[model samples]
Target: MPTVPSANPAEHLARTVDIVALLERGRAMSTPVLRAAVDRLAPPMNTVSSYHFGWIDAQGRPAEGDGGKAVRPALALLSAEAAGAAPEVGVPGAVAVELVHNFSLLHDDLMDGDEQRRHRDTVWKVHGPAQAILVGDALFALANELLLELGTVEAGRATRRLTTATRKLIDGQAQDISYEHRERVTVEECLEMEGNKTGALLACAASIGAVLGGADDRTADALERYGYHLGLAFQAVDDILGIWGDPESTGKQTWSDLRQRKKSLPVVAALAAGGPASHRLGELLAADVKSNDFESFSEEEFAARAALIEAAGGRDWTSEEARRQHAVAVETLDAVDMPEQVRAQLTALADFVVVRNR
Candidate 1:
């Protein structure tokens, strides 16, 4: 577990606490509930989901593998604590958000034709696209079932929030896929798409626990705002990693976003910068769009495009934007009334997102 980079002197105490331990607490609490939900799926769906969750190998044998960062679940639990409820009170919300997150991952991997995730074969590559779609749908439905079965008003409220976020997530994915074919996508448009795709779900995760704990709309909304900005910061950093992160750290090929021609923050910002490097980068990208045979691009070609994108200031602009969003996220917390310890943890989590290497 790597140390979380501290954003300020005030965060020193929280920064000293291991973020991995915080994430593990979320994973440990949610795994049993998550597994139970998945177990309810019939036949191959259950088996396939187990494999996707890294609980089992493709052969159906048990094997510990990368599940995920469990960031959402951690936030969920902390949100409950923020609302003066026990962490266990947030388990259902934690599991539900995790379900929704994985559901998107399944569909996104298939839609993007990504063959690997977390250093393992993706569900689509291992089982087939049809199975991937079916399992993703099942997980989504199970998420609703888990919450609804609770039969509490809070549960109902949380479900409504989760469904709305899921819809926005879908919308974001649609926009993302469409952006790939278009020659020009404005930075504003990209931010809107990302807000829908990544921000919505994180907003839900950040607030759903509090919703379940019976927090008022005002508190929930403020927390959601915090999460929404944090998501943007998270995505900005992710965009950086997608283009510049090491293959070993990112678990993807070099110039991964470039190969996919994703109109991510860096690309869009660079295109918007309007200079010699920007013009050349746009021309090269346009040529790729015209040819549209991204698979044929060599390592040298991808390297050249990446260099142009940086020279155009895409990388630097996005780095600054990440810190800006992170600051805004932390500021939002000031408006909420919560325990100082929980607030520290949330601030630390925000710091983790901006500084995470992978």
Candidate 2:
């Protein structure tokens, strides 16, 4: 992983402290509010949401498990600070975004038929698809309720932003599902889908806090741009991980995306880069398409496809694109004037986004 940038010893220590501290800080600040929001659900939904959040086990016993990285909440809080407001001012934004994020996860696991996440049974797997759909709907409602109840102009603005992003996210998911059945998905098409699916919500997260903190549109827009590019970088890295990441860390089986025949960035780029290896990779993929025999694919078959992707420079291209997007994300920050400390923290978070393993 890349080291956090440091200008001087004292600044470095401050940046490091801020960087490490914000994740825990965000979790601490957002969890109670999020739990309270989840508690609004009736009966089994409450139980299911609680279990999904890792606050309890499947048997209703209190047990701590991995929740998530809390990246959105941290960004919300940091964005508040960037707007020259107290971090506490961003708590509602933090909780709302976190709620929206988990809502997506619940639905995504069910839609994608993913049985595992964070090394545990997915809500859909453990609780069933009915509960997953119900609880996801409940969470989405709760996210809007939390924001709209604030009853301020800024709150109204933030709600509109969140809803807009949610619509785009849904659109992206639709595009993703549609792309799966098609034989050819262009690199441009893939980026657009990812930009909507991943980038839209991240842009909202990056600016919603500032909106709630009463920031002007210019500053909020700049931060939104920062987050949009950061989201692209994040998804690119994620595509790479989907193919080559360690299953133990990723909480998925080996060759996970390949098993699903996901046309992620690497796969699209590899097919776009024509060569002997690329042609062979295309043949293999075309054969799989015709057979529709992903389940019967042997370990060696998946491994050979992975190797072909690498030899065709798919992996390297995606990696370079990640760095390029990261640069753009960081550069967008220049348009906003905020505390120096907050700037460093946002940059650190952007670094974390591009370099993160999961």
Q: Pick the candidate with the highest lDDT.
A: 1
Candidate 2 pairs with clashing backbones: none
| Residue 89 accuracy (lDDT) in model 2 | 84
Candidate 2 stretches with Cα past 4 Å from truth are 1-18
Candidate 2: C-alpha lDDT: 0.88
**Model 1: worst 10 consecutive residues (lDDT sum):** 1-10
For residues 1-358, write the lDDT of model 2, one tens digit per residue. Answer: 2232343223343446555577899899889898898888999999999999999999999989988888899989998999999988889998888888888889988888888888899999999999999999999999999999999999999999999989988999889888777777899999999999999888999999999999999999999999998899889989999999999888888888898888899998999999999899998888888897777779999999999999999999999888888788887888998987788788888878877887
Scanning candidate 2 in windows of ten residues, the lowest lDDT window is 1-10
lDDT of the candidates, in the order given = 0.91, 0.88
**Candidate 1, 173-208: lDDT as tens digits:** 999999999989999999999999999999999999
**Poorly placed runs, candidate 1 (over 4 Å):** 1-10
